[model samples]
Target: MTTENKGIVQRALAGLIETGDVNTLASFLSDDFLHHRSDATTSTKAEWLAAVHAALGPTAGMQVEILHLLADTDHVVVHSRRRLPDAGPEIVVVDVLRVADGLIAEVWEIIEPVAQTAVNAAWWEPARL
Candidate 1:
């Protein structure tokens, strides 16, 4: 079930990136899906879809590179890097999705802009014990 849930999220994200079709993305969501943003705002399925379309439509030229996927029985967390069309600094986005009955029922997302300065250890380096 955990693996299945992860796959469901992976496929949904891939579909959105590949086709840029809101309907395709909609197919993976539950009818009563809700999206909770980092800003403390929540959006319904329809509202989220509309937002996605307006922000990341085909011509937006946004690219998403998934960095990590972690899942349990009913939740999947995806950490990714997003590059917008303007070629500005990359953004890191983490979405935690709750899956029920093979569809995504809810999502909580956080987004942060990549820092230009060296603040800490390199992201690619393995943690030291």
Candidate 2:
């Protein structure tokens, strides 16, 4: 069975950034899912997929390194680092998700550019534990 926790979101996001496979990613999101990013002015899933595809079109690969994950009655928080094959690595994003019926329905995100105060680590490290 598919896991119904934040891992599902992370895996979906990973597939999007790494492979630009919006179809695979879309299956994991609710029809009303909210999407946010570092530079987003809108939150539509189509826009989100478009942006991911645009970025991956030039970059060779992408990766999301989740730093933290917190869950409650209806939500999950994922702090992550997004890396590009050409740009190297750094801590980049923190995402908050509201889930319903095992699907992500809402999201709020914070994106930080590479900074001295941030630390880069494995995505599955603390986020899974």
Candidate 3:
């Protein structure tokens, strides 16, 4: 059952990013869900939905890649990747989630910027110090 929940949770998150469908996402979330962002800010379910709407702007093109998944009872952890409309690709995003009463009740994430050595090594003149 936990495995099924994990799959459901992951799919819901993916759908949220893909379609910017707040309603669909909300159905799977607890009202008091605790969300810990990769940037370290915590928010409730309402806040998260608002943030997604703001980020979507007039065009929605965000994409999510689920690299791996692990489930332990009501807890689900995922290593994932996301691509934003105007942002470069990043890697190593870890999301920890808790599901209760058939809804996602808590979530935490850690994200890291992808090291772009090629871009970094490009010849771009730095400002005079």
TM-score of each: 0.86, 0.66, 0.74
What's the candidate order when arranged by decreasing lDDT?
Answer: 1, 3, 2
What tens-digit string does per-residue lDDT give for candidate 3 at 1-129?
788878878777777766777778888888898889867799988887787666543366656677888898889998877676667565557888898888899989776656764554454747422
Q: Which candidate is the best by lDDT?
A: 1
Ranking by TM-score: 1, 3, 2
Steric overlap count per candidate: 0, 1, 0
Candidate 2 structure quality by residue, lDDT tens digits, 1-129: 124666777677777656667777778778877786657665787776576566554354666666777766677887877776776655467778877887777778777668644343343477656
Clashing pairs in 3: none
Candidate 2 CA-lDDT value: 0.69
Model 1 score (lDDT): 0.89
Residue 72, candidate 2: Cα error in Å is 1.4
- In model 1, the worst 10-residue window by lDDT is 116-125
Give the whole-model CA lDDT for all candidates, comma-separated: 0.89, 0.69, 0.77
Top TM-score: which candidate number? 1
Q: After aligning candidate 3 to the native by TM-score, how far in Å is the CA of 109 from where it should be?
A: 1.1
- Summing lDDT over every window of 10 consecutive residues in candidate 3, give the lowest-scoring window: 120-129
Task: Evaluate residue 121 in candidate 2 and report its C-alpha lDDT on the 0 to 100 scale.
Answer: 37
